[model samples]
Each structure stands twice: as C-alpha cells, then as structure tokens.
Target: MILADIPIPDLELEAHDGIDVPHDLVALSEPLEPGQMLLLRTLDGVHRCAEVVGLDFTENETIYRLTYGAPMAPEIAAAVARPPRSALRHWVDDIDVEVLLGELADAARRTATTSQAAAPESSW
Candidate 1:
C-alpha cells in the first residue's frame, strides 16, 4: 500500500516524564503494520524519521519497535544527534502517520534551498 495513502488516526507518544504526548487524540480507523515509515515528534517537538521494524505484544498492550534514521532536518539534528541506544519502543497507539510524508518532503525542499544558497556561484 502507498504509505501516503494510509489513513492515520490520532496517536500519543510515551514521554519519558510519564506523560503521554498526544499527536491528535483521534481514534484510528485502521491499524499500522510493520515496515511503515513514520515521523515521530519528540518531547521537545523535534521531528524524527523512523521505520517500524517489529512489534511485541504483551498480555496487556502492544509495543512497536522503531528504528530511527539519522536526522536530515537541521532542527531534528540539533535536538538529538543520534537515536537512543535502545531501539525506540512505543505503544502502537502512540504513533501518528498523518502528514508525515508531507513534512519530510517540506524538510527536503528546505535543505535543498539552503544548500543552493550556500553554494558558490560559477563564473561561467
């Protein structure tokens, strides 16, 4: 399935402070599967790119194993130089895939623009 086409419901992130950071707080119509890419907003509001690697189900809840990619956006890079040593494991309900692709695309455009502006002009 096209990742962009997938409908995303509101999600919450499990914060280190024990507070659940809600993405949108809306109910999900469909469930997210492994291998889907998503953008996660850290507690400080930095957006990180990630991929769902696996899922673990306990008697009570389901935890998702996410492998984060190196931050491409400057803001994200400044927030966290690297993903946590342990794989990002969060409850499935804590993730939101909505508009993730659009955000990434926008970040890419911004990076490209910045690079072009910094490049030296050719004399020719």
Candidate 2:
C-alpha cells in the first residue's frame, strides 16, 4: 500500500451558514478517502464537518468539493479550498483507502522528485 507522512497545519474555516461549527479544523496528518467526514474550515472562522463529495488535486494542494444539504448554494460550492488536502483525515477502514493512499503516495513522490530536480546542485 502507498504510504505518506505529511505534516499538517491548523487552519480555520469561515462560516458559510449560521450553523457553522466553532473553532479551526485541523487537517489530519493522515491520508484521506472520499465519502469520509471532514472538519472543513473557511478563511473566515467558520467550521463544519462535511462529507467528501469530490476531490481535485494540484501540484501544490488538493481542493475539496463539498456539499452540506440538499439545494446547495452556488456561492458555497464555489469557495471550497481552506486547510488544503494534505490535512484531510483518512479512515483506515474506508473502502477506497487503498486507492487514496496510492494516489497520495504518488503525489507526494512526484512532489519530492520535482523539488529535488529543481534544487540547486549541492557542494561539499
């Protein structure tokens, strides 16, 4: 199975609805899978536990596409990035944990390789 140990930074979520949870949602240091619950924090100071509806990853970070209730608002759907994907909680028993782990491992490897390749030559 793919393995990763990325350090996660604590981030706060902005309140989208009045029922938002209070406090910053720390992105777990563990890997994550779709359909798991996540403590989502916004740029403001709102927090909520949302299920992973979808995911989009880039070289720098992963963007989560989340949903709350039926008849979702367009504004909430548009601004979904906050703590970044590196901080998501991955449930070990999650059905797709294997695949998610693989993808995360691959992404982490690619990032490491890219960074190493771009680094200046070292001198003893």
- Report the alpha-carbon TM-score of model 1 versus the true structure: 0.39
TM per candidate: 0.39, 0.29
1-124: candidate 2 lDDT, tens digit per residue? 2111112212311233212221123244554566766544444334344665666666766555554333212233222323334447644455456655675666667667888999999896
Global lDDT scores for all candidate models: 0.47, 0.43
Clash statistics: count for each candidate? 0, 6
Compared to the true structure, candidate 2 yields what TM-score?
A: 0.29
Whole-model lDDT, candidate 1? Answer: 0.47
Would you list the clashing residue pairs of candidate 1?
none
Compare the candidates by TM-score and give the number of the best one: 1
Give the 10-residue window scoring lowest on summed lDDT in candidate 2. 1-10
